[model samples]
Target: MGAGGGASATEGDPFWRRAAWVAVLAAAYFVAGRLSLALAFARLAAPTIWLPAGIAVAAFLLGGPWMWPGVFLGSLFVSAASGRTAWVAVPIAAGNVLEAWLGAWAARRFARGRAAFERPRHIAAFAFLSGAASATVGAVIGAASLCRGSLLSWDGCGATALTWWLADAAGIIVVAPIVILAAMERRDRWNKEKSAEAGLLFASVLLIGWAVLGGAPASRNYPLDFLCLPVILWPAFRFGPAETALTALVLSGAAVGGALRGLGPFSRGNEIETVLLLQSFSAITAAAALAVAAVVAERRKDQEVLQGSRRSLEAAVRERTETLTKTLGELESEIARRGLVETALERRTRELAHSNQELHQFAAVVSHELQEPLRKILTFGDLLKGMAADPRREEWEYAERMEDAARRMQRLVEGILELSRTTGDAPPLGPVDLGEVAREAALDFEPLVAEMGGNLFIGPLPIIGADRAQMRRLFSNLISNAYKFRKKEDAPRIRISAESPQRGFVRILVEDNGIGFEDEFTEMIFKPFGRLHRRADYEGSGLGLAICRRIAMRHGGDITAKGRPGEGAVFAVTLPV
Candidate 1:
């Protein structure tokens, strides 16, 4: 076999491995035979019975097809050295060769991944039966052919065959799994990580039981949950199942060894006792191992479910918290806007009030000082009218002059007072029935509406938080204007309704189809004394919006207008709920 290629050893190297195996097999047989003879010489030649076991174990460890010739040759050498004629030794030699060959065949075909003595059933299946057959066949054939001098009868041959089979089987079951396990134990694979610890723990249950505790307790008739089984399961649970399974097998073999070696009460005796003990031990241990596996697997499953639940709950809480925080931020921004609007309104109100105060003071002064002079002019005009003979022209001219001068001062006083009285002592927050207010406003304008051939319709409304007087006045002003500004060519229609969309506010809308103005004048029309139409076309103090806007501001709300030219205009007033 060309089994070499410098750095990369060729596939042929396994031939060398096979050759080395043969050599070791031959040497072990020869040495064991010599040792057996020495033992035979020492104890007055009584068979102490460890010799055949040595023969079988050596062959089991090193035997293969190529090792057959080596074992046969080694057996021949043992006969030559023993000083016993071929008649006494050649049959033993042939039996050894046959047993070794059979073991090697079984191992090559079946024991690649398994340890020596890995299963009692496997031993019962191949190791025992194969060895028994090899030993019986070789012994009967070799004894008949070469042992013509010994007193070997059928009974003696059968006893010897049974003994040989037992010896061979003991070696195979006790030793092969261990050797196979060693071969499988790569340092890189079997390092003492958690898995390794688990393996060692499992294997140690048998080893330690054999070394320390000796064997299964004499009192146990069936499998009980052993302390060691749980210990093995702990690592098996944490590390993995493969390590645990392998370890369990190792321990099982150990348990068998302990039972067979006669160190405990449960040690092998008759064939029946030996088989039952082995069967029971293997079945119980395997069942316990399986039970541990089931529990550990379930624990891992539960852990995964719990971990998923925790993640889902945390995600839900995080999402809910984020939504709540966003809503709070929006509310805070709205509050800030309200505060800004209130500040601006306060400033503007103060300015308007101050201007009105100044105008009122000036009007008071004018009223006291200018009115007496106007009265005296009227008196002189009357006197002139009485004194003139041609009275129609003189009286008409004097009266017209007096009336024009006095009317200018009266207009100034009234305009000043009306603007000043805009905020005539309003009440604070209270419950206002908006339905009642709308009805009252509609009633106030009903007579005017009939006169103008216009209609005002009120819709459903809700009770809201507000100043009752202010709300009533506000509705009344809007209805009065709706009827007051009817077009000559078309019938005026007004619709009023209330709706609450905002959680914190109520909205009341007054819609109308009338002689609507351009939208550009919408903002300008809300100022004090601001008018969109000429006085000849429509008459008003133009303070309607100013009052509406003031009321809305007082309630922390607003009024907005949306419309198209000549279609209709809608006034939306939002009041805090």
Candidate 2:
């Protein structure tokens, strides 16, 4: 039986549990001692015979190291009180003490988590090794006691030594293993699901019971000898030799009892080979059981590993399916984008052709209107040139101004027509490096900004799809306005910044240190011919800003401005991402 983790729990466990076990052992020792005595009086007449009944088994099994006192003292009392040679007592006591010590030492040394009497390699190595070693000490002391007192011959002492070995081996094997097997089978806890124990315990009850019954028929005088075989084999498979020795003790007692009473058919010599054969049977059975258990455990481990690999493969398939779903979504979006671009191109081409036709009609109407105005201006100027010695010289000057107004109107009309047609067929959207566009535009206006003693700061920029020439125009127009409007003696500072809020869009900002305007004029500035300052003060056609707004709308973007009087103005331009 094997167990791990923690001590198995029971009611009032640990301290009380240990106390209960020790008390039970103490009670069993005394009771078994008394019973052996009563049984002895009914048979052998010597009480010393009762000494083997429980004292040896108790000392070897429960007492651990402390069993020496009970075994040795108990033996001293039993041997002296019995009919053995009066002087043989002390020597026997020494042998018992030595045997107890060896059992304790082996328990502390080789015993593992398996029950105390669990099966070790050899019962002799288990029993006789420690038993033989510690018992040798007792035998030597006994021999010395016999030699000094002259109570027995050297050969007789030698025979007594052999008898002592028999008794000790008997107690350690027959009784020890059975008690340990019972205790182990009593244990319900296990490391596995507990099949190993089920097989062993089931076989233990069957084989050992058979041995007890069959041994009786084999030697009617010592039929108990059959019981010794199962007791020994049980320890080999279910327990170690400490318990085996205990099993051995009960068998020895029974064998000796049956032989002394003339109840068995066998003579003493027949029992020797019987002893050797039991060991052989135990050795083979123990070896086979252990080998089978090892193979089963190994096979179980392999099956678990294969199952884990199958689970991992299933998870990888799920991840691959998710990746394919995302790819399909992107494919769908691409198809929709190309479809929209085709519809927009067809619609825009028709609008452009119609606008061009209207422009031609507008030019003709403007040309006709301008001819009459120019003729009137000429007639007035000619009248003024012919007014010789006239009192109104200021009137002649006013007529000259009329001709100037007509020439300016003609130039404005031409400029308006040019603005409508320019940049109408700009290239399709593509990845445009906005930073490169800003730098090139800045360089073109470098000479002008230097002349005006202005500073231009280009902030962070991002790239997007846009026409490069149109971007250059947008930047040039904003910078020109800022430079021209700078406060007297104040440096013009232009800062350009761009942001990409999404993958396909960009926003560019142009801010300047110049003479700013009021917020009320914001909408007015976008209208044609709308100007905050007189044309005499700023040489502009007032159409530059209106055309800038139109170009921004055509690109699917827009421009707006915010300013505080006497401070500065900032123009925010947003383009499609």
Candidate 3:
């Protein structure tokens, strides 16, 4: 389990889910306690192997510190129900919780938490820190509690504590690895090959253990426990920490059962000596198996890494060869194609030059010839209206219409001339204060905005390398559109602001509460003569936005617009600082 596994399960989980896991942990602890007690010597506070110690350590390591309540409750209930004094159960339960906490803390700090079995150094640290050291806490407290409650003679307290400590240590060395590694084992690790090998390995252990330590085989009790070493070494070499742990545990059960019946090598000693001897053997065997498994696991990982690096190098070489072959063919084709491209490019350059000359000629014609006639028309129409004897007559109305047409023609000609200039050349750039330009633009619309009960605000803007006149025109056109397209029922609310969105560029935003356009017209509205409303409803040559876009492009900047049907619109102009 990783740090995220325990933390997320404890913190992100709902109260009921966490409670259910705690309940399950408590139940398992109690049941393991009962089974451990069944193996205890009569009238003694020591068991051959206290499996619940392993359960507590594994719980704390996997479930995190929040699982302490479960350990406490389980210990309290089991101790009290075992006919111990009710008050004695309190200190014993506290001792169990402390032992688990200490073990988990040490493992997390030095032994790699629940991953202690993965490497040899971490396995050694776990053995010394969690298994041996933490077991002392529970042993001392439990023995003292029993003696204080008058349940055991003071003379026997020291022997009982020694037995308790060894039993707990052995339990941690053997059972804890089984539970932890089994929980973390991936389903993909078990296949036909591994399953068959594991089955064979475990079967050999059980058979060898029964032959060397079984009570029924009286002739086999010849102090030949060393014969089991070969069976224990098999899983250590072939399998992982979980499998090795289980094999040691199985052998331990067989050996202990036979010794208790006075039919094994350990049975030659007195009862306490026999129990201690068996525990020492079990702890040493389990630790050695886990350490050897860690070493083997490390070797396999190194081999896999070396093989992966070799494969990657070969694949890279093959890909490079293929790329070189393909590039040579492309290079030959490109040389032939370059000659044809040069010929076409020369022809297009000539056409583009001719087009530019024609555009300049058109601009001169519109400026000198077209506006003169529109001005004469406007002057003559006004004189005719003054000469009409009856101003309300039909002739006077016709004169008024002629004057309006002439004025509209003048504005259209000027707009066309402006648009032509924007496409002609890049304007000279300078550090122009955009805040001052925006405020100047806002001043032009102030009276109209005030009369209509609307607002126009100019926010702080950056001094950017831009053409001052073009920046002014950009702000003017955007603000004018905001006012013209506003809803009649609502007062126009417009705001201009700027922000540095990236390292080198600043974005200016003009937002308005107005009658916005459809999404499909976001691009169309930037083209010349791209009008959404009719001429009678809104007066414009539809060249304002087109001119704004051209001005932005000349300054190495851009303008974009976003809007909904009626909610509002935001026009963003991004320029380099």
Candidate 4:
């Protein structure tokens, strides 16, 4: 049972399977080599052709070094079948095996791993090193073996060695790459164009080969063997190495067969010389075809790589463009949203301004209405005073107080009306001489200036765009304030001057020697009804400064005040010219 199990295990092993394949290949090599030798055995010195050397090298390369035994067995069978003694057969077989081993080694070492002849340089190296150089070894050893066995004379050994060497070399150059490449070729389906081109190439090579070396007596004079090269080159450029090598093999076989029949260009010489010439042609043709095919394959591979890179770059650019376009769309949406918000804000501001204008108009109308009622009260109180004279002291006092209160109320109404009118709508503005307006204000206060024992001075001013009445009222309010808030012991002195502090605007300065207040109250004095002094101390409504500021602001200008406790005050009003 243990022996039975061992037999089953050996049968199942992968090594046995590989060995079976090698045995089958060796049998095929023996048959092919014997047949080739038998066909060209006209001259023993020149066997003319050897196919098994190429077969052995290709088998070792494809099946690894373990296939060397197949080469030895194949060589031994072929030599022994040729009717040589064991001594001659053994040495010749050994020489053949050594040649195959050497060729396989050179191909692996120099032809770039696995003998993949995909470049011109690699193809050239394989043809020279593996085909020509390694075959010399077998040729020398086999010729020596034949001479020792008395099968060949030493005088003819040189010629026999030369013929053997070239025949083996030609066989390798023509057959090895074809077998290797065909075994490893890609299994792509042949399209219609490729099928058509291949059909044409094969037809042309056959026709041209027959015409040039058809073993016909008339063919030698034509010398048309060169015509077959185009057909060989056709497949080299368009197909892979396998097709190129196959085409070259077919053409070479046809040419050599014709020469062997003594009807081609190489048949003009002696038997040995003729066969050598044929072998040389076959070797050169095989090498050239393989190299060109490798170059074409390399170029195609490079083009494929370049096209792939270009596709990737284009895809990246498209992706980036889409991202940028999306970002730009978002920015546009944000800008549109901000614009809508600004429009809403502007609308609210206009509505508020309209409401303010309506309030000012209403205030002016109400002040005018209050003045008539106050005047009636004052008239009635005065009449009562005159009628009750000398009747009672209390009656006289009450009547006098009534009249004073009525007069104060009247002044208050007038001040409110003036302030509203200045701030509300006014007539269109024109060019007015501000210096003339200042002089008019000063003249109006001349009587009061003289009575108070004070001096009032006016300086030259610029012509500005303004309402004339409004400009006069603006200066009147400022000058009156200077006169009203005077220092009793100082004999108040007031000066009004104008200067253009900057382009497009003029500044009017009203400096006074008056009892000024704190600097902190500067902005406070401009508010409506804002007063630093009690009514009993100043004897007028506190709306004067407020009205002046309103008028200046309406003309696109402003007014500011500076003052110190005991020093004088200066009011600067700026207006656009």
| lDDT for 351 (candidate 4) | 75
**Regions of model 1 farther than 4 Å from truth:** 1-13, 41-73, 76-98, 101-138, 148-431, 442-466, 480-509, 518-560, 572-577
Order of candidate numbers by TM-score, starting with the best: 4, 3, 2, 1
Identify the candidate with maximal TM-score.
4
Cα error of candidate 2 at position 498, Å: 20
Estimate, for each residue in 366-404, the C-alpha lDDT of model 3 and write its tens digit. Answer: 666899999899999988998886889888899999999
Please state the error at residue 203 of candidate 4 in Å: 12
lDDT string for model 2 (332-382, tens) is 888888789978987897787778757756765675676677777777776
Q: Write the per-residue lDDT of candidate 1 for residues 413-525, one digit (tens) a residue.
A: 44334333444434577787898888987886777666767777788888888888788877877776666655667778889998886898888998888666687878886
- Lowest-sum lDDT 10-residue window in model 1: 1-10
Backbone collisions counted per model: 7, 42, 0, 0
Listed per candidate, the RMSD to the true structure in angstroms reads: 13.1, 11.9, 21.7, 8.7
The TM-score, computed over Cα atoms with residue i paired to residue i, of candidate 1 is: 0.45
My TM-score estimates for the predictions, one after another, are 0.45, 0.46, 0.56, 0.61
Which 10-residue window of candidate 3 scores lowest in summed lDDT?
1-10
Ten consecutive residues with minimal summed lDDT in candidate 4?
Answer: 1-10
lDDT of candidate 3 vs native? 0.83
**Cα lDDT of all candidates, in order?**
0.57, 0.55, 0.83, 0.81
What lDDT, from 0 to 1, does candidate 4 have?
0.81
TM-score of model 2 (CA atoms): 0.46
